[model samples]
Target: MINTHTNAQDLSSWQQKYPGVSEITTDYSEHYQISINKNNQLVITQDNYEESMIITDKGTGFSAVESIVFSDLFRIKSYEAYTLNNVNGRQKKTEVAHIADKKLDRQSVFDSDVKLKTFNFANLTTGSKKVLKYEMEFIDPFLLHRFMFATSAVNEKRTLKISYPETVKIDYKLFNIDKNNLEIQTETKKGITTITFQKQNPVVVKQDSEAAGIMYEAPHLHFWISEYQTKNQTHPVLGSIDKLYAYYHTFISKINQTENQELKNFTLDLIKDCKTNEEKVKTIFKWVQKNIKYVAFESGYEGFIPREAALVYERKFGDCKDMASIITEMAKYANVPNVNFTWIGTRELPYTYQQLPAPAIDNHMIATYINNNELIYLDATNATVPFGLPSSFIQGKEALIAQGNSYIISLVPEVKSNLNTIHDKIELSLIDKKIVGKGTFDANGLAAAQYRSIIGDNLLKRKDFAFALLEKGNNKFKLIDFKEIDFDNSEKPYSIDYNFELDNYLVNSGNETYLNLTLDKPYQNDSFEPTRSQTFDHEFLQKKSYQVVLEIPSGHSVTYLPESTTFSNDLLAYQFSYSQENSKVYLNYDVEVKQTLIKPKQFALWNESLKKLKENYLETIIIKQHEKN
Candidate 1:
């Protein structure tokens, strides 16, 4: 028998190729078969999966556990596991056990029908392999999930093959795969088109903190049955954006056909005092956001279709789709013209409807009010989000808005850095080798949302959260007192006035004293790895301004002060200035994050910028003792 494990020299080469990985999939395959069901719906008939994993490091035993995740759309049929041990250079099959089978814990996020099926190898030495085999039967398949050849570990050889009748027209697009570099082959057999995507030793990128989603970097294939043909007719499924919209409309066409008297009465009564259309609509939308709880309820067909508006109002809780329905109904009832249900993908999904035109392209639903050329997005799921501002996650995304039977695609406006801002004004004084300061931190837009999420509803723990937000000067920072203003109002900016003291923060060597005045150094420890192939994405654009005035101790002479430094690039901008006038020292620092993505080519520039910033952090204002106080 041929040896499947890598040799001693090849083992080190594999390790070098895939850093931070001790195991890899030597052989993995996904074989899919599709056909038309009784309802004439394009469905996946069978899905067969096989995987063989081997340990590259001898120090750690191969206890590889195979996890099979499935949802209500699919049913697990068979599962098998085996441990193949390399005893005396000969392969031997050991135990077989399916360890775990249970529903996934869906805490606070959603109630899901997804489940997990897992099997594991107890303990196999180096060069030993673990094999897993499983099959699934699709109940109703709408979107074909993308297949990623690149995983968390290296894939020595991974294959995905789908077989369907020639009548069904399927389309697939490759992402981030260099066909010229990989050994790609295509062969047609028995008059059916055979396309092969073969890559050799595909290594997944090492993970970094706050990196973009894998969909943006992984070598994957997005395949969907665009349409199918019967003997007499051809049906369009998702061949074009219009076709996808048509299909999506069918789900909500029958919803809210009959209005609930209770809902209408409540909405009319709630908006009785509101004279203007905008005011009435805002009041109704806020009522839904405040009363109805948002729980993502996902099952088979329930995941795609929205419940009736009356039913959702009766239950007082629904998923994104359901909340959108009630919001639309109530707004329309309250004389808000042109209120419609909208579909959009959040920032996490970085693809547009034109790119894929599949349900997989969008994961969320909201409500939109359109008049003439203006578009207002209403996401009731976000209870505290302001009326005019779209949620931070959905900003700058393509929205599919409903218009009768047809639809229009529009991009959500991105909030600028200045809108979501944090501005600080602080005054500091040195006393007994310690620093004492009083300041007020003001935040607006998404910047305020960040602090609100941390503060939560715990009144007792709010002070500790405030301290953490303003913490600086190592862990010795202390918060003496704090008071908040306008925190409960979503439409207004919030402020926190605080008194803080830092013990022994100043460095005193004999007569010379050193101090760095910059606090809240955002992204100081963050940098895209020099070798990282992926881009770094920030969730939102932000601007921070820090103005601190320090009083120099009496009888102390200013010996040195750090000069003004500034750096500006496409993605970020920074400015730092230090000045001394009389006995008062001032620092005016500002940072504006212009864009979300830092491309791979800009890694060196980004790293250099961070390096300079850190060096400036080391630069301190030096004070010489002219005379003892």
Candidate 2:
């Protein structure tokens, strides 16, 4: 039997309070029990999780959804869910049928053993509720799960409990958790210890545009077993950086155990003519970047281990770890000293080894070269990034470098805004009712690398890509011909010289014609929302300068010009200048984004700086017929 007795007023109040929210978790609980396995390795013997949520929106009321992704290291023991109806302010539960357990191969020229388990609470109505319970077994103790206090949606009540025997020791790190809201209790009894974390409500989750990653924003707990005690002796798990490194060493120790003469000869032949160590490293790095294509694939523990160097070399394709392996082996074969195999986490995971010395903290691997105490990170997965600079995603991240029995942590340097620049110069002329121009554009550093990566070697996409980036004026603007497109030499900027015409860019009224001299305006209407809570992210720092010299039409005089303004502030610096000499009028626009994260506190300044540019973009230049004396 089924019954429906809903409270309209309560549902309406909830709907008004949390608009656009489809579901709200009323309660979520997770419990874990750790114990020693037959092999003396610590394992999660019992892992249980449950979540109960109420439907807040009519659309989502029809169906509630949940999923679990598992790899070889973790397996799901059981899963059950039920849809509960609001009957007389009480709950009546009905079983949810057809739980889907299937393999989902993430294929993009790659294969893996990862699988997905999903179920939906179908036929749910507004004000209805749902409950789900599941159990998971951790095959590997080192790869434990991090418990997040809440999702993007509102969480009313949440609890997490972990139980372990007296022989096991555990350590934890808390991120973005407020001490005021969190209630922690620890107790030991009957030769066992249990810890619990309870919270009524966390922060109001706000999904800001371009917000930092969830790991950086969410309140979460990451825990690991530091060590375990046995009747005979003690076994270390991951107490220090050295222990983590030692565990990682097991995966790569027997990788290239046998000689790889083919890879060695190939590497030797590739760098035979290189005279300097820098040259050798650059040569090897470029070879891997150009040759080996990156493909992600993981199976069992192979996800953490790098395959043999020779195997990857022969295949001509590998993932990040494999690429790191080859880059390291090749550099060593060429007699490059102080080469280190490195582990790093991209900006998405904002944790250092000292903060959480666990395998889960790092998601990427690279090869680093040390010279005069300067760490040169080489990430061959980025085919366009040059040797001296790291890929933008890893900037400001700590690199865990392997140096024989010990590890060194180094910070990847951030590229200066000036280094990654865009300087374009154009000479414009007023043709028959149109604007015609010949321009030369230069993009340096990471900007150049980004262009190269996008344009690649495809001759067909080059022109269209260039047009998309350089398109300005009006819809009828046309790119006539590319005089030059050079991306070969890393020493120089990625430069392009072309001729173009803006068909309807200028407005004319009798003898007077109007033109917006800030032709290539960037960051127009780029403003942060008032409701934004997190820091804004920029893919890379930028420095852009656009210059144009318009030849005064014959027998015409400048009647109106926008005032020039120049100012520099902490968030950004901008300049709009106009100068006239002889028969040509010059206009220059410059802007530099000085920092990566535009903090909420700097929103006003950031928006104001861009507002000035937007205001100038509306200002126009007027050319009137010269008055006869």
Candidate 3:
């Protein structure tokens, strides 16, 4: 039983006093108590608790939460000196602090008005057990660095025994406020709300591990328990309009004045440097990116605007907000055009800005404007990236532009999702029964970008990487010419075309070996315990065209060739074919991920398809021993 009518004043309060408070531990276990009751409800109970930070902002009447666990990624790797599955620990004092203030204004807590104190958690363990306890304590609210803090206790083996709900509902209202620049909405719902967000297949969820470390990232998250009364009761709305207005005036005024003088002086001086408006804009853009390094250190008020453009210029370092402010001020100084700051999110969290509210969308970055007609998105931190192009993360999201007393919402460019295509063409001459060939490879879409980001600025390494794609092969290889397409230009489809040569793919007699390319990186079979039972299934759409042309040595006859194969299940389909014409062997393969996401019930089918693809890539052809001419 839970108490539903307890008010703030009625809650337990002892000043949270601790005498020697050096160490504490907690053990929590969750069990599916009920699934699909007569009222079509789902219930699960988690017996978990420890020292955790709770945000209670009067400005927005809503509270944010973050719980620190002993086995989390940061403490495990940073302090314990652990790598992967390995675990280690060191002796240190734990600190605890608290802050009850306004709604969240920025992600970090550099200039925040929060209280601080220290506690201890020197006694912790690394071994596995069904029930384990870890101690956690509050820290200055402004000290939190990431967007959210989540527990890492889940793995691939966790049990999810609850039944599905027929429908899910959500209700959101003004939870807290921090003027126009910042606000927090209280969102609550009964029934299964997570199911409503499922994609067509639901399998896509399984592709990326929500666990601690993997590519294709998303932010930390916090969820609270629900306690309701038998009947609904109307709640009063909370507001702090006076405080919000006062804070906004001071913060905005400080940011503007700090950068104003510098902009006026710079604009006057740049007048003599650039004869054309276009050159001037380009020059300024280059200067901002080259000079600024995005290092966010938000303690308290520093989270608002930067210290000022002059201070940023002298320091040569600032966070995303600071970089945006510097560029915005410089534009004014140069008398180029109007530039505005905007917010955006990366593709990791797929939320439609038009459909979802503003707060759910973006966490970082700003944009520049031209004559109030054209808009350009700039992220000075990505120095190597070309202008007009943001990292794949910011593509296709909503951006909020500051307008007088209000804010306007705008849509960023839509990201093009396409099937992956990898083509490999190799030509080789057999000397002493050793196969040699020059190869050209091509790829596109997200797959291409993933590969290019890994290839970096090395040509030899790129060729070697391609050869490594031929994972299991007994051969010495040499790569010749590798030509890859432009990866940074967002306007162009992601493409990679490279050329390479390989040697020693055949035995002394005439036997030949072939290599298969299947799910690499994120999908590789690495072992990790799962915390949630509902594993997400995903489908990968791919096509490959490899044309291998080889000439028979002296007097030789064709003895064998690979048999063509095709496979299709309810979730996916794949086809592989090989042809021999004259003295050349042509191989063609195509795989289509018909569905986007999958549910737990379909994991077996998805797993089978992946297994078949891996086997097909390993198929080889052999030629019978021939007489020497």
lDDT scores in order: 0.79, 0.82, 0.43
Candidate 2's TM-score: 0.92
- RMSD versus native structure for model 3: 14.8
Tens-place lDDT per residue, model 2, 1-629, is: 12344467766776776677777776778888887867777778544555544545543443366777876778888777778876777777877755786777556527677888878776576677676777888887788888888676677767888999989989998888866668999999898899999887756667776765677667888889999988778889986888899988877777766768999999899999999998999999998988999997777887889988899999999988899889888888999998778899988787888889899889888989998777899998899887798998898889998887787889988899999999999999987878899999999989999888887779878789889877877689799987545587664788889899988788889889888888787778578878776777776888999999999988898988788988788878888888889889999988888888776788888888888768778989899977667
lDDT of 3: 0.43
Which residue ranges in model 3 land beyond 4 Å of their true spot? 1-150, 153-287, 330-338, 346-362, 368-376, 410-414, 417-425, 440-554, 557-582, 588-609, 621-629
- Winner on lDDT (1 vs 2): 2
Number of clashing pairs per prediction, in order? 0, 1, 41
Model 1 per-residue lDDT at 54: 52
Show where candidate 2 strays beyond 4 Å: 1-20, 53-64, 86-93, 104-109, 204-206, 457-460, 488-492, 560-564
Residue 74: error of model 3 in Å? 20
Model 2: colliding residue pairs: 61-124
Candidate 3 TM-score, true structure as reference: 0.52
| TM-scores, each model vs. reference | 0.90, 0.92, 0.52
CA displacement after TM-score superposition, residue 237 of candidate 2 (Å): 1.9
lDDT, candidate 2, equals 0.82
